[model samples]
Target: MSTTIVIFDPANASHAALLPSFADIHIACIGTDHTIATFTPPLNRDRIIQYWEAQAADAVPGRRIIFMALAGDSDGQQQLAGYVVLFRPLTETGPFRGSVEKLLVSPDFRRRGLARKLMDALESEAKARGQTLLTLDTETGSPAELVYPKLGYTQLGIIPNYGVSPVDKRLNPGTFFWKQL
Candidate 1:
């Protein structure tokens, strides 16, 4: 598999056009994969679009950074396999920390180390930008929660009822993790 990681540039119309594909990934994760996220089935597509569009509004260097994984399919067409986001303060001053968001790998692309690769790139990029620490949270016992410590992230703590599962609509505990760059 030929996989390439690209930093999203929403200022470019072509790049903005790809936002729908990104949303589709999230939708699949929730509806098909039954992953825990900010939403569940019977989702409002417009809400996802708006949320992603707002990211473009905050696309400044210090405000947000979105990285997307693209791979060539059997048909020789490139598709989004996964993506990750790193967000810092908008002022670009007095902050050496960033928050990790949306570390998503398409179900079809799972077990391929794509999430690891995306995280590796995110850490490298964050360090390059002078960030000293990164933080993220995921469903307490989810696969993602288990993967972080393997990526050098230290568990902070777990909060009960931090999120709702997409599949069962049950309140779930969430685990927080952090890594020093």
Candidate 2:
């Protein structure tokens, strides 16, 4: 890979260029395939744009953390790869519960275990925040499907017709997975 994946808080001062990388990763993670199971809510770009702006400012309503994978080669001026965004409720009691909001690695940078590294960083963040349970969903055929299991995520259940298909315009079921940290 041409870029080094560095995990840092999005609240850092030098996050202007880094924001687009995070946005792109979020988009790539949710491909054009509507049938792919995802966590996207039904909203237009304006709303999402506003929401991300809030995220960039760490102004989201709940307990959330955003991480960016940047390039050590680009002098910290360019965004090289993907990012992971996770959320956990503060009202919950023992052991935190989390939703792996987003995880994506650039296509050119896949298969090098960056995703795992990002997840590791995210899990560490979650653990540090006192979260004990985390949940995320992925398409059955996507490369991500193999990742969580090896990382110790248990398959909780499958939700049929959970996503809309891009080709046929039909909904496809997605596999839900969770891990107890």
Candidate 3:
């Protein structure tokens, strides 16, 4: 259980090495985790790659705070076990707020508090950025929808038939939640 949480540093060579694993986590979750019904399976890998690469310049202000939990594998290589991101809008004037992106944990790492750990760091990072409110959504009745309330987020409402499952094209509802940092 050797794990260390670190903010993604795009310029860091070690961090760059895990780029594929970072993308792998998402694809794996979408394909296997029934609870993550937001995206259809066979997701465009380019989407994750482009988005993460675009966040390279935001490393300083951390406008897009990308946190990755790296754990030692059997061969002692650090693998991306889980990750989550907080995106802060660049608007010059307005209420400070951030959007929580997908909180993904490798299935092998589930039930180990990695999601909670990733989220705790996200909330703390949000506060440090002077953000008082955070918002996100998950599939209604999904595990994430259940976890948010326990993590201090209040569910605003559910959007019926909010997404189409890529796996089976089944419609899934979405739950919106927020927390005051």
Candidate 4:
């Protein structure tokens, strides 16, 4: 199957259907007991859809929040394979920095390099916007912890008891990472 990575257009109603699957994927991978900064599953899909629409409408060029998705070709039936969000700070004066948020791939679509593809696209977009740095955080021992380092991100430090796991509701550590663009 061929897949294409593109910026999600919030105005497109077709993309809203993909949000539920994205929520399900995150819940399955991170467990129902944990919540990331960008998503807390058992998602309020309607509210999230509204939020994305608002963000997309209000987005400023080069300093906007974007949601990128990896989806099957539109030639036939289109399927949302994975997604990630890149948030560029809207500060008036400061070093340009972008943050990676909510990187997820469907369980049925794992092991196919979708996450890397999404991240690479995000990095390219950030650099093109003149961003000089990127930052992100992941569960300390999660798959993403390994993936980030492999993608050239430097570990900043681990935050103890940073968040509660969605599956078990137990506290979990989070590791922060940064990359110079």
Candidate 5:
């Protein structure tokens, strides 16, 4: 199967159909106690779709959130293999900065380097938009924590008892990271 990364278009019905799977991936992450899922609330399929729809409509060059999906094509069918979200402030002033959120890959797609590709695309887009820094937080000791440093992100230290673990509902530490563009 060939996979391609593209900006998610909420206006497209085909694209919208991908949300349920995305939500499932999200829940799975949470269920696994991943850092990205720390403190994540319960998932609601309809609400998730609505939220993405609103986000897509509000997306702009710098001051908005954008979602990029890694899609797989097999025998003329497309499936969302993974996705990531990048968010930038809407203010007209101050240093340009953005944050990464909700990076997820389907279990079947793991070990295929899709997450790295998504991060690379996000950083490139942030730089193109003149963003000077990118920030993100992942659960301490999570796979993302390991990956961010490899991607040139500097650790900003770990916050103890930062959030409730989605899987166990117990307190867990969170690690913050930043990359300068």
Candidate 6:
């Protein structure tokens, strides 16, 4: 497989367009093949569209939102296999002084290290932008739960019912993860 690691920010025109591709990848990643039924966030078509629209080149956040996409190549084909989104925190003591709102990998592309590549790109981009802290939340059953701590992310407090599983009415607890750059 061909893999390219790069850092992108929504302010860039190309990166902004990639946001929609990232959203599409996320949706395609959550399914039986990925076994993410227990961790899938509650998302609808409208919400997905809103998310992509919010990342437009001119729709800048008060603090910029950095987007990182990992493209995988196979059979002379290139496609976005994973992505991450991070924003600088406005708070004085937020862990890592930044928050990673989203991290996703295509279901067919999981277990291929694409997620790790995306995370690494996010970390590098964050540090380049002078962000020292990085924070993220994942459900108990999330595949990243184990990989994250191993990746040097310290476990923070947990938020009960933080994850609303799309398949169930009940919520799954979410553990927060953080790391210093």
In order, candidate lDDTs are 0.86, 0.66, 0.81, 0.72, 0.74, 0.67
Q: Give the higher-lDDT candidate: 1 or 4.
A: 1
TM-score of candidate 5 relative to the true fold: 0.85
Report the number of the highest-TM-score candidate: 1
lDDT of 1 by residue, 53-157 (tens): 888678754488999899987888888889999897744574788999999888889998899989999899999988879999999878788899999999999
- Which regions of candidate 6 are displaced past 4 Å? 9-19, 32-47, 57-64, 70-77, 91-96
TM value for model 1: 0.91
User: What number of backbone clashes does candidate 3 have, counting pairs of residues 3 or more apart or in separate chains?
Assistant: 1
Q: TM-scores of the models, in the given order?
A: 0.91, 0.77, 0.88, 0.81, 0.85, 0.77
Ten-residue region with minimum lDDT total, candidate 5: 60-69
Winner on TM-score (1 vs 2) = 1
Candidate 1 pairs with clashing backbones: none
Model 3's alpha-carbon lDDT is 0.81
The model with the greatest lDDT is 1
**78 Cα displacement, candidate 6 (Å):** 2.7
138: Cα error in model 5, Å: 0.3
Tens digits of per-residue lDDT for model 2, 66-91: 66666454454565576677776566
Clash count, candidate 1:
0
lDDT of 3 by residue, 1-181 (tens): 6887888987789887776777778788887776463446568887866655666557557678889988887788778999988888867684488899879999989898889999998888888878878999998877787898999999999998888876678887889999987
- Candidate 4, residue 140: lDDT: 82
Global lDDT of model 2? 0.66
Candidates by lDDT, descending order: 1, 3, 5, 4, 6, 2
Candidate 5, superposed: residue stretches over 4 Å from native: 33-43, 60-63
lDDT of 6 by residue, 1-181 (tens): 7777665655557666676666676566554424233235554655665666665432365364544445545666556677666777566665348787667777767787777777787788778777888887887776778889877999997888775665655677888888998
Window of ten residues with lowest summed lDDT in model 6: 31-40
* lDDT (Cα) of model 4: 0.72
Off by over 4 Å in 3: 35-39, 44-47, 55-61, 73-76, 93-95
